[model samples]
Target chain A: MTITKKEVVHVADLARLDLEGEAIDRFAGQIDTVLAYVDVLKGADTQGVSPTSHVISLFNAFREDEVGTHLEREAALANAPDKDDENFVVPRIVG
Target chain B: MKLHQLTLYEAHERLKKKDISSLELTEAVLDRIDALDGEIGAFITVDRASALAAARAADDRIASGSPAMAGLTGIPIAVKDLICTKGVRTTCASKILENFVPPYDAAVIEKMKAQDAVIVGKTNMDEFAMGSSTEYSAFKPVRNPWDLSRIPGGSSGGSAAAVAADMCIAALGSDTGGSIRQPASHCGVVGLKPTYGRVSRYGLVAFASSLDQIGPIAKDVRDCALLMNAIAGHDPRDSTSAPRETPDYTAALKDDLSGLRVGIPREYTEQEGLHSDVSKAVAAAVATIEALGAEAVTVSLPHTRYVVAAYYVIAPSEASSNLARYDGVRYGFRNASGTDLLAMYRNTRSEGFGPEVQRRIIIGAYCLSAGYYEAYYGKASQVRTRIREDFETALEACDVILSPVAPTPAFPIGEKVDDPLTMYLSDIFTLSANLAGIPGMSVPCGFSQEGLPIGLQIMGRHFDEKTLLRVAYGFQNATDFHTSKPKR
Candidate 1:
C-alpha cells in the first residue's frame, strides 16, 4: 500500500512533470500520505459496483460536427505569444 | 459613473430609461478597469475595442426595441479564465495555456453575448481549478479585497473578488468542487452551482467535467438568479444540457417557504475539524433560517465522511486524462528544444503547471492507472452512490438542507499552502452536492468577530435551484448579511 520516492518520480514522469531534489522527497511523503488515504478505499466491499465515472447518468454531451464560423485569422492570432501569418509558432519541433 | 459599483439590475433600468447609454456603461467600466486593474490584478485580458463594440450594439438593440436586451443589455460582466471566450486568452491560470485563445466561446459566454451582456475581461483562477486558495494559480494569486494578506478563494477567486470590489457588475465562474461558492463565501458575495448539466459545458476548459458547472457570482441572490436565467438552458451543442424547460427563478422568489422543512445535516455540523467561530456563525445562520418559518431539523448524510474521499478520487482520475491534452502541441509555453516530443511534453507541463496542479495530476494518474482503477475509481463510485442515496432519502423528508459552505471562513493566504490534506478538507461540505449532481448555493449568513464573512450553504434536489433561491432570498430578506459589504 506504500509508494516509494522512486515510484512517485515515475508517476511524475508519466504525468510529464520533472521533479527534483526536495520535490522528489517532498512529493514522496505527500504521495505516500495520499496513498495511505486512498488505502482507506480498500476496506469497502464493491463487488457489484459498476465504475461510475460520472455522477449524473449523462451520455454524449457534444457539439454536432457542423462547421461553425470561426474567428478570423487576425482574432485567432490576437493573443498568441508568437504567430506567423497562418500558424502559431512554438519552439522548432522540426527534426 | 463608476462602472464597478453599478449592479446589473440598476444599469439595466438606466439603459432602458435612456438616462444612460450602453456605450457609456461600457466606457465607464472600461475606464474603471484601466484605473484600478493594476492594483487589483483581477483580469488576465481586457478586450477594450470588442467590449465597446458590443456595448454600442447593445445600445442599438435597445433603441430597436429588442426584448432580449431588456433583461441584460448594457450590463458589464466578467469571465473566469477557465471558460472559453472566443478570442480571449484563457490561461486557466497556467502559463502552459497562458497565450491560448479558444477558437470558440463557451455556451454560457455565447448566451451572455446574445443578450448583449458586455464581457469586460477574463478573471484569474487556480491553475486548472485545483486549489481552494488561488495561490495555486500560475499567475499571481488574486488577493482578497477585504484584506490583501488573505486569499480570495480559489478557481473563481478572481471573479468573486472583482464583484466584491466593484470591478465588474457580475461575472461568470465555473464551479468544480466548490470553486464558485468557496470563493464567493471568502469574498462575501453570492455564488450558485447549478445541478450538474443544468448549465452547458460545451466550451468550458474541462477539469473533471462531470463535477464542473458554470454559474454566476454577484452582489446578491437575485442577480445570481438573473445571470442563471440567462446561462441555464438546453444547448444543441451540449447533449447533457437539460431539455428546454424554463424555470422562472425570479418568479419563484415570490413563493412563500413559510412552512418549509429545512434539514441541517448533523454530520457537517459535527465535522471534526470545524473552527469554533465557524460553529457559532453557522448556528446563527440556522437560527436565521429557522426564524424565517422553516423548521430546522437534524438530518444525517451517513456517508458524509466518504464524500471528499470519493471526490478526490474521481476528480483527479478525470483530470489526469483531461490534462493529458497539454502536451505542448496545442498551446502555450513550449520548452526551448533539444528534447524529444515526449520530453518536450514533460518539460512544458513541469514548467507550465504550478505545484498543486502537478500534484493533483500525479495523484489522478496513479489512481486511474493499471492495477488501481478497480480499487480506487470503482470503490469511490460505490461510495458516491451511497452518498447520493443518503441525500435522496433525506430530501424525501426535508425541503432543503442547510450547512456551512466552508469549515472556516477565509484563511490567510499561505495558512494551508504547505499542506494538501488541510486544503482539500475545506471542500468537505461542498463535494457532496457535486457528487449528488444536485444544485447548491452559498449565501452570506453572518460575519466572524474579526469581520470575515460566513456563508450558509443550502442544498436542493436536482433542478430545484428555484427552491434553493427561494430559501436564500427569504433568508436574505430577514438578514442584512447579503447587503453587508467588505470595506476594501
Candidate 2:
C-alpha cells in the first residue's frame, strides 16, 4: 500500500498541518517508508485469535468518589499562548 | 561528580547518608546539564532556583530523620514534559502548548514531591506524545548519549536520553504504545510501561486515554522498581486507577529465577518482518533466561499481528476525541482570533497541532465518525477483543512473554522521517503491550552492527507486574549490557 502524495495531502488537510513545498515532499517520503515497513501485517497469521485491547487481565479499574482542589483560574490560565480575562482569547470563529 | 551521571539509587544513598546534600546533588546535575545539554537538548526547563529550594527542603527532611521523606530526598529526577508540574511549564513539545504552565502537579509529580525526589527539570518530548522519535519535538530532538546524531526513541525519548546522558538519575515517561521502552533500549537504559491503570493518569495530557500509561525509566531494574513503589497504587483522582494492592516491586526482584515459566510467542519470533538483530537479541535473551533456571516454552498469540493496525486505529480515535478539549477558549494554544466558536476551533486546532498529530486527529475523526464508525472504529474494537483474548489464553500457559521492544535500534534521524508508515512500523514490536494494556519493559539486551543498543521486551499479565520485574531484573543480573554507557 503505497501512500500516495494525495493521501499525504488528504491527511495533512485532515490533520490541519500548514505545509508547503519541502514539508509536503518530506512528509510524503517519510510516510511511504513507514507504510512499507508496516506492510508486514499483510503476511501475519491472525486466523482465530481475538485482537486484544489491554494486556493486563483486569476489568473495571474504577476509583472511588473523592473531592480534590483544582487549580485557581489564575494558575490555570497563566500558560495560555493567548488569553483574556479568566478565559483564553482566540480568533473570532463565526460571522 | 557529574550531576547527570549519578543513578537515582546512587544519589539517594548519598543523600540519605549525609555524604552529599541535596543542594550539592542538584547543583551537580544542573551544572552537568549546563555543560552538555547544549549538545543533547534533553531539558526543557531546568528550574534551578526551584530545584535548589526543593533540595534544601529535602536535606532538612533528611536531617530531621523523617522516615518517609528520606526515601527520595536529595535525589534529582526528571519529569517528561507531558507531566504537569504546578507553576512549571508543561509543554507537550508543541507550539500549541508552548506556554501551558499547568496550574497543578500531575499525580505522579505530586507523588515524587511527597517522596522528596528533587526535581532536575522537564525533559523534551514529541508534541503530545505522538511521534516515535524525539525529532517531532517542537523544541529539539534529544540526541542519544551513545551517538548525538541518532534519535533516542521518542515521545519519551528525552526522558530516556536524560537518564542515559546522566541529565537525571531517573525520569518519568508515559508509554501510549512503546514510547518509554523503545527509547530506553535505544539509549541502553531501563524503561518500564506499567500495566494500564498501574500508575495514575490524572494530569497526564491525554494522547490515547485507554492505552496511555506512566512508568519509570532508569539505569537499572532496581531503580525502576523503587520508583514504581512511589508512584504505583490507587489514586482517587484517576477513575481508571487500579484499586488492587500494589506489590513491593523491590521485594519481587531477586537472583532466583526458579519456577519462572516464560512463554515465547512463536508469532513474535516467526513474524517474517523481524529485523535480524532484534530477532537474534530476543533469542539470545531467552537462552540466558533458560540458563537462570526459568523454563521457556513456545506459545501462540495468534492476533499479535493485528496489534499495530488495531493500535493506530484505536489510539488515534481516542486521541482525536481527547484532544478536542484543547480548542482555544478553555485551555491550550490559541490562534489570533476567529469570528465564531466553530471558526475558533478550526483556526486554533489548525495552528496548534503539528502535522502528524493533525493527521491522526483527522483519521481518528473519520474512523469514529457517524457513517464510517461501524466499519473502521467498530471493526477495530472487535479486533481489540480478539487481541486481548490471545494474551489471556497465552498467559494462562505461562507467567510472562518475551519479545523485542522495537524492530530495530534507534534509526538515523531522517531515515523514516518521510514515511509515516515506516515510522509507524518501527513500533511493530511495542504496540501490542499498549493495545493489550499490560505491563511491558525494555531491558538492554545487545547491540546492533552499528553498536546501537537493542532492547528485549518482557511482558507480564495485567496487574502481575511482579513477574515482569522478576524476569527483567533476573536477566539484568545475568548480563552486563546495561552497564555500558555512551561516550559524550
Candidate 3:
C-alpha cells in the first residue's frame, strides 16, 4: 500500500501536527513502508479470534469515591508555559 | 577501593558495618560521573548538591541507629529520564519536555525515596522511549561504554551505560519492546522486566502502555533482585497495579537450578538475521544450564514472526492516544507563532516532537483513523492474542524459555537510524515476551569477536520472576561474564 503526500498531510492534521515540505514526503514514504509491513496481518486467518487490548487479566478496578488530597492549584500550573493565577493562558479560541 | 566500583549489595554491606558512609559513596559516584560522562552522555540531569544532602541525611540516620534501615538505604541510583522524579527535571529526552519538572513522584520513585536511595541523576533516553537506539534522542546520543563509536541499544541506553561505566551503583529503566533488555545485553549488565502490572507505572511517560514496564539495570542478577524488592508492589494510585502479594525476590537467588525445565524456543535461534556469535553464546548458555541439572527441551512459539508487525500497530495506537495530552495548554513546550488555538496545537507538536516521534504519531493517527481501523488495529489485536496463546502453550511444556536477548550486539551509531523497519526488526526476539506479559531478563552470556557483549534471555510465566532470577543467578555463578568490565 502506497501512502501519498495528501494522506500524510491528512493524518498529520488529525494528529495536530503541521508537516512542511520535506517532512511530508519523508513521512509519506516511511509510513507507507511501515504500513506495508503490517499489511501481512491480512493474510493470517483471524476468524473467531478475540482481540486483545490488554495483555494482563484486567477487571474494573475501583476505590471509594471520596475527596482525596491532590496536587494544589499552584502545583498543577507549575509547568505551564504560560499561565495566569488560576488558569493556563492559551491563544484566544473565540473572537 | 573506589566506592563507584561497588555493586548495590557490596555497598550496602559496608554501609551496615559503618565501614563506609553514604556521603563517601555518593561523592565517589559524583566524581566518576564528572570524569567519564563526557564521552558516554549517560545523564541529562545530575543533581550533585541535592544528592550530597540526601547522602548526608542517610549518614545521620545510620549514626542515630534508626530502625528504618532498608536494603537500598543511601545507595546512589540514577533514574531514567522517562520516570518522574519529584522536584527534579524529568525530560523524556525530547525538546518538548526539556524543562518538565514534575511535582509528584512516580510510584517507583516514591518507593526508592522511602528507602532513602540517593537519586544522583536522570539518565538520557530516546524521546518518550520511542527508538531502538539513543541516536533518536533530541539532546544527544548515548555511546556504548565498551566502544565509543557503537550505539548503546536503547531507549534504556543511558541507564545501562551508567551501570556499565559505574557512574551509579544501578539505575532504573523502562522496557517497551526491548528498551531495557536490549541495552542491558549490549552493555553487559543484568536487566529484568517483570510481568505486566507487577510494577506500577503511575508517572512513567507513556510510550506504549500495554508494552511499557519499568525494570532494573544492574551490575548483577542479585542487584537486579534487590532493586526489584524495593520497587515492586501494589500502588493504590495506579489502577493497573497488581493486587497480588509481593515476594522477597532476593530469596530466589539460588545457585542450583536442579529441577528447572528450560525450554529452548525453536523459532528464536532459527531467525535469519541472528548473529552467529550470539547464537553460539546462547547455545553455550543452554549447555551451562543443562550442566546445572535443568532439562533443556525444544518448544515452538508459532506466531513469532507476526509479533513485530502486530506490535508496531498496537503500541503506536496507544501512544497516539496517550500523547494527546502534550498540547501547549497545561505544560511543556509551546509555539508562539500560531495565532489561534488549533494552529498553536499543530505548530507546538510539529516543532516540539522529533522526527521519529512525529513519525510514530502519524502512523498511529493513520491506523486509528476512520477508514482503516479494523484492517490494522483489529487484526493486529487478534494476532496479539495468538502470540499470547503461543507463550501459554510453550510454558505448559516447560518451566521457563531461553533465547538471545537481541539479534546482535550494539550496532554502529547511525547504521539503522534512517530505516525504521530494520530498526524495529532488531527487537524481534524481545517483543514477544512483552506481548505475552511474561517476566524476562537479560543476563550477560559472552562477548562477540570484536568484544561487544551478548546476553542470554530467560523468560518465565506471569509473576514468576523468581524462576527467571534463579536461572540467571545460576548461569552468572558459573560464568564471569557479568564481572568482566568494559576497559575504556
Of candidate 1 chain A, the 10-residue stretch with the lowest lDDT total is: A44-53
Between 1 and 2, whose lDDT is larger? 1
Alpha-carbon runs more than 4 Å astray in model 1: A45-47, A59-95, B1-3
What is the full ranking by DockQ, best candidate first? 3, 1, 2
Could you give the DockQ of candidate 3? 0.87
Docking class of 3: high
Question: Which scores higher on TM-score, 1 or 2?
Answer: 1
* lDDT per residue (tens digit) for residues B332-407 in model 1: 6777553566777778888888887788888888888789877777788888888888899999889899988888
lDDT of 3 by residue, B1-488 (tens): 68999999999999999999999999999999999999999999999999999898888878887756889999999999999988999999998899898999999998888888899999999999998888889999999999999999999999999999999999999998888999999999999998999999999998888888999999999999999999999887878778899899999999989988999999887898999999999999999999998999999998888999999999888898899999988889999798999989998998899999998988888888887888888888899999999999999999999999999889999899989999998999999888888889999999999999999999989999999999999999999999999885
Estimate the TM-score of every prediction. Answer: 0.93, 0.91, 0.99
The positional error of residue A49 in candidate 3, measured at the CA in angstroms, is 1.0
Q: What pairs collide in candidate 1?
A: none
Q: Model 2 Cα displacement at B393 (Å)?
A: 1.2
Q: Which candidate leads in lDDT?
A: 3
Score residue B392 of candidate 1 by CA lDDT.
Answer: 90
